[model samples]
Target chain A: MKLSTITKTILTTASLLCVNQFSAAALIPTHDSLVTVPVVSHQVERTSVHFSQPIAASQQLSSAIDSYTGISDEYWIEVSGKQLNQGIDLDVNHPQALIRLSAKQTKGAWLPDDHAIDPQDLSLFKNQRSIANAFSQKVTREQLATASIFPNSSAVKIAKKAGVGKFKLKVSKTLKSNQRYLINVKEKGSAYQQVLFSERQSYLAGQTITVRAAINYRERPLKNTKHMAFIKSPTGISQAIDYQTEQGKIRLAIPNDLPATKPGQLYELHISSQGRDGSSSIKRNGKVAFAVAQPTARMTGNVTANNQSAQIGLEVASEGRYEVSGIVFGYNKNKVLMPIMLSASAHYLQAGIQQVTLNFDPEILKSSSLIGPYQLRSLKLTDQSRMAVLHRNHVKQSNAITQLNK
Target chain B: MKKIVLSIMLCSVLLATPAMATQGLAFIHGTGNQTDAYSDYWTGSFVNSVRQGLNDPNKYTVINCDFDQFMWDSQAAGCLANQLTSFITNQNITELVLLTHSNGGNIVRWVLSNPTYDSRYPNIISKVSKVIAIAPSSLGTPLADAVNQGSVFETSLGWLLGYGSDAVSQQQVSWMNYYNQNWLHGTSGRPSLPVIFKTIVGSDVESAFWDGDSYCAGYQYQVALETTQNWLDSCSDGFLNCSSQTGAGTQWFIDKQRTRDSEPLSHQQSRRDCFNLDLIIKNDI
Candidate 1:
């Protein structure tokens, strides 16, 4: 039965207090056995393994073990189908089978808080049925006598066995939680090949992108397989490129063109590989995003150096930090000494045709060099974040700063 | 007694012939190939100014090598190596003092340290007496890393140094690290010749200004020093860090000197004054 708000609060408080009384090992599932999952049809090549007990997030396992075949708390399973003996591509967004979690309240800290179980706040489906949470009603523990069933049904039975229970069905989401409960995950088969982009962020116009694809096979490797990659722009522009294999993995380099669309546009990238024996054909599609960014604001200013402070006067577009960089050149003992690199930052809070003055000691830029008539050459103003050179000019004789030591 | 005195005079004249005289100094420009063989690279009439300062005409020779090629390119070092060989052979130079600035120091060191170059043109390596490197990029510059992955302004600055993208690519941090670790001192831990090497380091970086120091003193001024200083993390002359330019930990040199930008000099300016006629006259000669 559904607990009232007061009961939930009392239970929550009691659990927090009595949590230390229970064994830390008891919080984790003890059953270390796997059960076989029944498959649908003979035409499909499917393999499914089930953990008799739920796995906890904190449990440590060997990294050498695979998530599916070994003992990882997390696993990745791709769902694909056969068309004329060729494999279809599937990603996280579209899963053929669903993974659903069901929880029951047993004696002594039987279940973790619902918040811990579904930390992502996913919408819970009532009793693993199509009905949402609002329409579901509480059931007595005597009603769930037959809770364990194979793949389907028993949703209502499991809920009836536990007086307080909650369940959620998710597609393309990994089923993991701190709660100790029985979870059923049904997936159509594994993907034969996976293609991924080396860089996830958006690319710039006229840039080269690197793509990598790895083949996943349960049996023998594909012989004489040909792989190809293509990019289809938003304007329906398509181009096919050849790929080279390195250590049996396909690698392709895509040289993007000046983007036909505006900045921050998206395109479609597709890759397909087929074996000569006609037994394996894999195709994967991904979204390609790129942008052409503009430079930051331009700065117009002159800097003067004195004994106490170097005054910089400039007109800035935005109210942010700006870096003023220049080289200090002076004469020492009738010899033209070397130049030192100087840089300082100033923040302009006001925007739109604003003028600001930044003060810094001239000696910081002069750094043990003699003080005299010095010229600041290659003066550049740049935005701090974007590092865009807003203004660049040679101060020559006009941008002269002298340290009289006064 | 008159015949014996005449014999001594004849012997003294023979000993003072031109073939016995030692050739003087050679100046090599650093990275970006800023100096051509026909003109001064660092300062205005630098070759002539040094000659005048030393009050010597025929003793010193400046190698106006190509400045546009990548410093690591074999041709860049080969062209310099060829000039040193020809200068030594033609001048009947018995001993030579070498002065190099920036990347030029790297190339000269490569030619001297490499056994292959020493074997090919033995005179250039064997005839050298001392070397004075000013703000050399012996260990490479972090600015090169910035330039290779540079923004629009950084790229422009890199190009301004007479280095294109390809040349900037050669200056990446990994490449420079590898070059210093492997390319320098050749295959051996030390150079083949027992040459005495001196380094002039420029530490005029306004790093304090970045930290908002109140008493900002002793900064050397250059046109691009400020903009470029942000690109450098360590003590710098607005171009290269002091440690990289000086080969600090490599024990590659015999002695080292430092100049501050506040002292009215920078990487380029130090090269100018360091290789000046006064310095050559005082030390090399």
Candidate 2:
């Protein structure tokens, strides 16, 4: 799904950083909403390339970093000019290109660019001029990555000599002006574990269940990812399960005595793996949900029908669709009678009351006199889910003999 | 007036004699647990057929034992036990005969062998002179065993009268194996059963189904019966095989040589031989 243009504008403004010379309001809109930070330079020939579509600065930076190193969602700096001048400057009065980070971008945990590189060893370049940390304290290379104007001087660096990189610029810092710069960011992807049930049918709680997961690498070491499973019962309680992995699948039997499940209750299975890779850590999680099968079904209700009005209030303890069927008969003693079929209506029965209104054709009773006896024979209830009849009730001649005032 | 009083006194004195025993016949119909309160025992003609065949409506009083609950569990047995005791006491019955069919035979066995009732309802137990079980699943049915092993066909007759398959599955051969020797007799050895038990096994597969049968018919019953026969390793009466209908102790085999098609007793038509034997044989005993 594409983000609406209005949403993109709102997100862009929320994360864009302001430079010292430009007011917060002035830093918002530039050429197509790209923050233009002024670079320190003197009479440099500047050129601007216009693309048909306004490309997201983050996307461009991510591709550049990935092409150089497999690493993505890392900050990089890209300067259009060829020279790496040591002290080149830009006019501070002019509105120049500023570095911006997309609000939606996900940057991985803050860490030094290199495992060995310390905060003191970092360098910042504005138009190729290395600058000091605005705060007297040595800012970590990772800390100097973003542009913020509050402290007057913020870290700006060409960490990898890439033209597009992230920088934190202070509002107090002066630029020579008329110099173009670009600051771009790439959003990091989180490690994930996708869990799925091995079987397609609804399982009883005590039934043994097998699940499989696709583990994706993030910060966790490939060898040491500890797989674990947890079940959250219907009662908002969770406990770890002792699971065994065989042939790339996780299997465990749901405890037989799991607390009784309430109506519409669901048991959620959480499969996750955790590992620590020296200084980096990763926690991957996945989830699947199912309901527990009930052992017995209890039904309580009455099936009442007459020529004028008929209704059934059946409450089945089991869950699923059920069908009702019966036969209607009128007799005057030993005389043979043809059985009349009762019009049955079907509905899904849950754990509670299910009221159904039945309509019997008045024409079936038209032949008999109004003051005669009738019998509701073989009134049966069947569970369609299990494909079996659960209950049978017949109002025989003795009790069912009543006047059919049709 | 004096002559009428003298006639009434003489009639009362004759009715009170112990020689003219008031025998009660209880028909325990089975298999259709999903049946309603009034007609829990199959069709009305089932009892009528038995009555018509007995040809002794005046000699023997018949009562249909109806357990309204739909599940065939111990609860049904408990209900039957209570009804039996009540019927014996209320009807002033001196001798009672039990006629059980299908899983109803299990209910009778449970009541008789469950020792817990031996002391409580000694009268009802003592009053039972004989039990005539028709296609009784006393040793459990192989068809039930097949259902427990997961042979499910919706078009089959067992699926309709089975009541969610729970009742049928409970009567599986293995469960019945455990139930008969362990639960029934295994408690503290078999209780002293005073009643004489004779099981009538049916081996009529051809007449097992009828075209207009309300339960099931056609290729469905044929396929179900065929598959079930393979499980029993013997001939069947459409539902249970002959070996299962008769308990494991007695080996009653249908004669293969002199048998005619007319003698095969399917589960539904097991009552056809009612006239051949003396049902009220207690008078002779």
Candidate 3:
């Protein structure tokens, strides 16, 4: 078709703009830019009896310790009630109460003559009426020692099976001079609440990190709960993030514009939930830490393996030290993948394609009965200087190794 | 002639055997950017007492680094790794025992846990025999959260506390919990650390004004700790909760379990020679 000079000029400019847009789009790096070699099996053997069962990737991967689980089920109550002549009044609200008492000598006062108070000299009162058998069990000096000071700091657990109510603790005997006491009460048997991060342990920049909160009451998800979430940077800056309820779980996503973190520094996602179940108030706080890194480098998907070692190629965007680590897996007589050993190495490199070597020890191979045609599993490439994980692959089959000279 | 042959054989045998380990100690200070940790953070008395267990007292070094930054910051863990690597190389130390207090434990744990973070980390981990963490804020403390919350709590106590550093923020209970579950090791379900990390937990703070024991460490610090303990659990050393001190590594002993006279070690006293704490560490090394 014929066109005028002005129309041709406009068409030319539009075509150039389209080309520029395509170029820019291609330059932006994403997770797909990472070079990953899928697992490839060269030989297979079948056995009637399975010696080892396949392990799930979740179990095989390293995970964080869940030591603080059930922490949400406990809450601390401040001892700010009425002060009595000997002790103070406790307003317990949970089924179980752990009361701890410690004596702190005030300023300009000398140590008390008696360091400890006898438990037998303690009394419990409800509505000004003494409960004769309030004490669940007899507490000894050794149990008190576990709290702070032996014979000085004492703790007792009161089992109030009757449910939440107010109670008071009083000392029958008067304390000596300069021994002012402080009390702490912790209530247990609250709602069950926990927050967990996704299975992915590390994330690159421009990626979203997910956190899910499970708040349960009476074996069911708590309703009408208000959830708040925030991301605390390594530098202590807190930024609130938005969350949503998805599939009956409170899910929060980390923002895309997360600032780069220093080596060994982690960003924390703190989630707090508050709700009520039938006149009882419940609150829980949970947090999960994760590492975020700039995509400084990635594997090139080129691996050269020899009998003694395997060298992996990498394409770097920044000048820094890089580390490559992976577990070497060998096939047994039944063609089952068994982990042989883990090897890692690091080196400084310029912004270009580079190589790293993973040396396999001969003695380790001999003892494990490992041969060539091995697979590198859980292969990871980390930018040590930038402190970012750039690439990770589930499995990468090496170029073949049949035997070693040694 | 037979005696002469035996003597030569014995000399050869002795020469073939490797030399004994040259032991060294490094005293790592807690949060601030210390320039002279020997005199400022850990007094000469405490350092000297602990080093006496070594064959050569000169083999010890007091690390001075900007620990107020995050554990992985260049001035924090990086500075620590540099000084530790230098110590191991200069002294030809075959074995190293690190004595860290408070947040210092987290910094060292970073180097041990993420060995690939720096080129010097693997080397430092190899030469280290053990770490003795005293009153370590391993799981962190609620006091940090209270300070960072920065309202009435900060206005009333933040100035006196003066610990609003990055390290303190990182030690907020939830932040430390994140690190424990994700990055750090030696907790309940995490993988065991390559080096044995033994913790000495300070269970309580005693700052009676008239008592002589209260003045062993800085009385003002103990007083501040006593006030700050309101944000912590009952089992606290006026600074860190007992759970935090025993959060990461294996619990070596609590304050009353090992300290002389069964005296409870306050947060400040844990770094000093109060109640024979220095002697207890000395005997341990």
Candidate 4:
């Protein structure tokens, strides 16, 4: 990262590019690249010391990543910081198991100041001046406060929980297929009424069906929150729903069983609630459409290198959805490698498409090939297009032998 | 003398049967599922774990509200309320513990905030006690941004709600926006929620993270930060970035009993039906 060397190299490259393709390297250096690098370096140094004095603030863990483990269940969290200002995420290129810290210094010797703040180190965010006083440095304390949070956030509180809080049920699932639909409501032990809580249920529209509604609360001031329940059908005597204050949700399955949306029907499903005289509904689109459960295709296999070639295949069995992918698990020359590149969406695999020619640096596969045939991962329907993984250990397998098929 | 007497009485109640001594719970499921989604959530793993948490065989029940855009409107809410009312009446239920995951949290809030339907199910709220919300999207999810921008999911939700015509349907966006802004802020019109714990999930490892439809670990905190930036002033579960969900005593309780987030109902899980059994179980840890 030497500025003078970089400048000279860039100038040489640009000059060379000018002769090779004028359209490609169309710009001329405004100043000596060598001199400009140092000047820019000096500017960076000047801007860095904005907050030389460490401020006091507890680093709170984000809600999305496990604070204790830091490593995500599927992906590890790699934090990087320059000087004192850590990037918001920088999740993409960072390696797993790495914790990054950042901050800028107004001097070239800023490297020594760059390090993770030790939890035991108190007053890390202390002694910081008001942003108004630090205006020149642009290290406004207010901005820092805005950028960082204390340890008292909700995300941290949950991290402190000795037990993960869970929702309780009063009864069991009784929605029988091809039979009567039975829904029940109830509350667990009677101990925390002062702490208000309730339950609800709902149904989709445009379809005819019976539904029962209810609102269960913990008495007193919590009366505003509305808890409910309901069901949908094509058409018939709609089931009556109940909502009672100072009570718990109670339910019973309807005597008639209903069918799902058929081909001829242009209907979708929905369920929601109105809290304290207010209700919101979820539709079969956007942010939640994936929950609708679209027809999907699955393929499973592992990476193997018998000869000098590795072949992959995918199997399909979907109905109206698009896209599918398969990851061939294997080893190359020994370094861990995962080339995520497989996409099959929009059409079902009635005709199993199997066969993939993996063009890769044979070196990386030597170590991975021993891993065995990988049971392909499933792509969360959030994007029926992106081959990106949605969840792990989710790919459905085909009993019939399949090569990498789309 | 009066002060002494009151102190003694309070102490007796505390020593005899404090709320902490008696574990109360309620379970509600998110969207999706056909035959028995709520109860059978995660193929019954979730419900089973919740049932064990209540530590009562009969204490658990299922309210198959069938929300999750999985049920017919009007009817889903009404039936859910009925089931809740009957159960409270039948079980001498009082001082209950309440908990919900994802959309279930929204359903529970609606019931607590509305009373017009209360006549049918009397004193249903009176029996409740503690409240815990897990990854509840009290506010519209950041993923909704895409939906609002006219992604297939947003269009579907809009169409399903019957947007312009139905007040309830049209309320989706309004409610989410209002809820996100006020639940954390608690404006004059919208009072703050009265739950003991606003639990959230924190696990970056998810099925569809970038896709917005993934099980967002930050689902709760993101809404809090976007709306009342100062709401959760502390840390978050795992998925919600810590900065967004941090604030106040949204106290966290570490759960170590379960092997993994994907485990079957090792923690009290509930099954949906006429009775949601998850409402009865208690957590081992």
Candidate 5:
């Protein structure tokens, strides 16, 4: 059944309360049973057992176990359908097989691959996904449920029935209230399942707040496979929660609206996934930091001219930040110009290159309120799109500039 | 004593002379051919073409030095550095032709800039007759970030670095750091492109260049993740960027299919296209 807003808010509140919980099981959680996902279909050629799982944000995950296979196969398909049908005995050579939280959403992470990262490193939503992508390969879901943070602790370990796979975090004592929890993810070879991704969210016992985490691609919404915990103390100390919005954009959303939330606002950004592109974030020290959604205005546009010979233009390829200038003249635009090397002129797009470094040029094409758009040639046209983009990307003052006398 | 000294000087002169021989020509390597001799097929092909174009291999010893494709095999980068340092000292090296692949541009840049390499063979850098780069990593490639993740991810990300060398597995941190730290131009190091030297073909980015930072464009919100516009603006091919693509010469980015216009070529095809596009640069600029 669909959940009502009231229920969601309550659920959100409950999930918020779950942070600040810590478990002290120095032993890597060990599970009771085992589960192996088999390669489906009669086209069974060979399979590499994957032990995978999701690592919640603010959690650390890793593994030392090497590679092991269930059965020996005569041949292995190298790429999708292309195979090494030589009946060459295939073996799991290294300790590299495991399922992972691929992505919190259908979309992938900012970087192509992911890894187990420090919390501070997870501040960038993409970095969070990087850490998750790095760990999901070592452990699987089944392995986590039966495991434990402490020998008897359920925080790190998974229970037989993780309680309806409830979307909530279980906290511990080590964490102080209102502090953010940076989690990690890792894999366990000998487990109930082929792979398992896990997390351990814990914050202090001080001030606290709650928020929902989501993953997005373009504009489509995706699920948050994991949740981490943290605390924001009333002592003007707090962290931010990173999130993947409904649009697949990995965002570092800070609770700018919360009553007590401020720069010192502590937050734990919860992230999870089957491993494709699960999101996460970290701080400057390489620790995972929660992210707050920040939407800033970015300008995009072009520059153009009317004359036919030396047509020049510009475009802003960045956010609302820059300085632009060039000369047009007092009364009317008049002058001979040469092909400006974009890179040479910090403002220009340099030869055939674009993006790397930037420099805004003073208005090279002068305007005098007496002319049409600048022209590349007698017949050739020019605009920011076709011309060298730079200057005011979205905004240009005038188009009347004199063409260089060829 | 005078007789002995004269005899020694005469012997030295004799040893330095080659009978009825022409000057040694130059050989250039494609980008990132540093994995090893076998892994760099492009370099081998470049060697063959150079040999064929010149009609002599002995006169033009194409130094297939290690040019790590930015995978950060310190060993590979080091090996190339050491060997080239030696060649610069040992070989008479008549005319030098800097034929590089992707970041090979940076490799050559390093060679010419280093006093040990360039000073010993000042003529080599000066003789830099032509720079025929094959999809050189003039600009970095963002895709390279994946390569740094090591083995586990590589097992998952296969088709990534089409030119898979040991460097691909070498973490992404160093490569990024190297570009940010070292990549730059010198005053009199690399010879100016007197002749119309050219950069090869391919497309790299199309989707959302500027992703992590993006805005709505069409039905699906556009991403700054890796948009062509963004790449042209900030991101790079596995490693470098567009602004970095230019040098002290005439430059061009070819996309005959226009696919590169919208979607630039991934670092791999950018190389293969080098051969097909060879016809253009062979004679014309």
Candidate 6:
């Protein structure tokens, strides 16, 4: 759906209100009197993207080992796959592995005791070279039964220098005659780069999202890297997303014509990066999920406050249940604005302008010794039916309420 | 005159103390749309054993909702809210403890984190005293990724291993990271939740034919879990990595640390009455 001119006009009016009232003073008058306090409403611009697909049920796998056949001798299991600059760094990604070989009984039962493969019979190799000291000394029969394979410090050091490459686990010993075993490999640790999105969790369909990537556990930029990115829908459909990079930041716009997502499902942006730091190769994968919302309502920038409550105006586009939530900031005994209480209320409204009330507790005000010239901060309106965040205002100041009786 | 005086004294003693808080329990299943979770997901024995801690054992409900949808979906959290609210209101429960397994933790966490999401959510949050999550997939699992990967080799071989559902996709390693950072709470540097959320981590999977312990929750299930463990971290419960279980909430204890005789709890066993897990939870509540 395209952005309408009427929506633009509403957004412009809201923007003007923000510019005029955001800097208003939160000072309370020494004497109580009727006054006009500007309520700053930071209204979000709404788009016309609505998703209307029925939610799909989660799939369940019948079995996880339907493809593997019982093996009685040596076997090779690929630890990492060779893809386009996507080879994993063994040291950074998966440094240690627990390999267990369970004996398969004729009656389809798995026996941990009968298979007689020792820890010395297992070896890890990159391009078929034996890595010494790969297993720690704790791999007794008891440890093997539990599949606990701890990596030695020397082995970890050796893995750090192995760079980014495909790894394979090799079982050297043969099983007893007429016996078959099943192998299970488990690995851990990822020292890859960290990727994060800039604050907001939901965005308009046409809005841009910002992402930043840095080295593992450090804020340093991952420099001189090549990135491939894609956006995956809830239905497992993937589309390549074009991104612009500047100073280690990536920006991608949510396409207006993107397919509708199922209810409560989010779109994921996946990024795969590959680079070289000196002679060592680095590969990392990161993703972030966000909801793209269609605007169904906007705030009217009008508020009325009394001794006990405040009513905020909203302009609705359709009939549904909408919710308004905000934090109330009142002046303390020191005359500084501090958060006093948070209040939220929702109501069903027709397609027109309506108001929702935030009733402040008198006990709360009395206990905090709060005085007026109160302000509402972090005001938000959500379309509960659509499950979308419709609008947000950072701050809104209210008129002084006199005689908040205990 | 003596009999009347003794009766009056007994009545006075009863009225002196306030009424005890009505404690309630709920069992939330994971990853599927359950209609009869009491029998299908968590058997009757497990639920009954855990609910023995309640002041009124009858004050518990085994929630049967569609958890296969995303955590925030109407069928998921919306249904949960409805049932829990009914349970609280009908039973006059003042304090409620939630027992969640796997993705059930995420659904409950969604309600706690976003109190304003639904009109029913705030009330539910206020009533929840604590959440005892067992083998929670708080962080997504690598096994999910491998299953959803649907590599050409597996697809061509006609053994896709797993059904690629929205719930499975959501639990992928990267997807859970995204949800934790942006939507959920109680992770490191994220906002703390309104209620106490503690996790029980499952550390290993054992399927020995000779060992009776391996057959407690179904021997075949343990075999499948052992095979899937290959896709997880060494510190995994066959289905989820140990880090994933301890990802969102406070770590209550690992499997061997608290289970009967220090036996490890597999992913499936965590929901069953195996290894005296139910007794442990009963005492805690």
Per-candidate TM-score, chain A: 0.27, 0.30, 0.57, 0.22, 0.19, 0.59
lDDT of 6 by residue, A241-305 (tens): 77898765678888766778654467776666566665555555555666776666766655555
| Candidate 6 segments exceeding 4 Å error | A1-187, A190-200, A214-223, A277-282, A329-340, A363-375, A393-406, B89-94, B112-129, B138-163, B172-258, B261-264
TM-score of 2: 0.35
After superposition, the stretches of candidate 2 with alpha carbons farther than 4 Å from their true spots are A1-406, B1-18, B34-46, B52-75, B115-120, B150-158, B186-192, B207-227, B248-262, B271-285
Instruction: After the best TM-score superposition of candidate 3, give how far the Cα of residue B248 lies from its true spot, in angstroms.
Output: 3.8
The candidate maximizing TM-score is 6
Give the per-residue lDDT digits (tens) of candidate 2, residues B1-285.
999999999999988875866677777766554334224433444454444433244333333333222222334655566667777777777777777777777667655543222233345666787777777776555444322211111112213343324445346444454344323421112222335566666665442345333122233433334323333434677667666676632323342222333344455445332222222222222
User: Which candidate model has the greater TM-score, 3 or 5?
Assistant: 3
TM-score of every model versus the real structure = 0.36, 0.35, 0.64, 0.30, 0.32, 0.67
Model 5 interface CAPRI class: incorrect
> Each predicted model: what fraction of the native A–B Cα contacts (within 8 Å) does it retain?
0.00, 0.00, 0.11, 0.00, 0.00, 0.07
Model 4's alpha-carbon lDDT is 0.28
lDDT per residue as tens, model 3, B91-184: 9999999999989999999887766556577788889999999988888876565444311111111121226667877787766765665556
Error of 6 at A315 (Å): 2.7
DockQ values for all predictions?
0.01, 0.00, 0.07, 0.01, 0.04, 0.16
A246: Cα error in model 4, Å: 52
Report how closely model 2 matches the true complex, as a DockQ value. Answer: 0.00
Q: Relative to the unseen true structure, what is the C-alpha lDDT of residue B99 in candidate 1, on a scale of 0 to 100?
A: 73
TM-score, cand. 4: 0.30
Could you tell me the lDDT of residue A155 within candidate 6?
14
Weakest lDDT window of 10 consecutive positions for candidate 1 chain B: B149-158
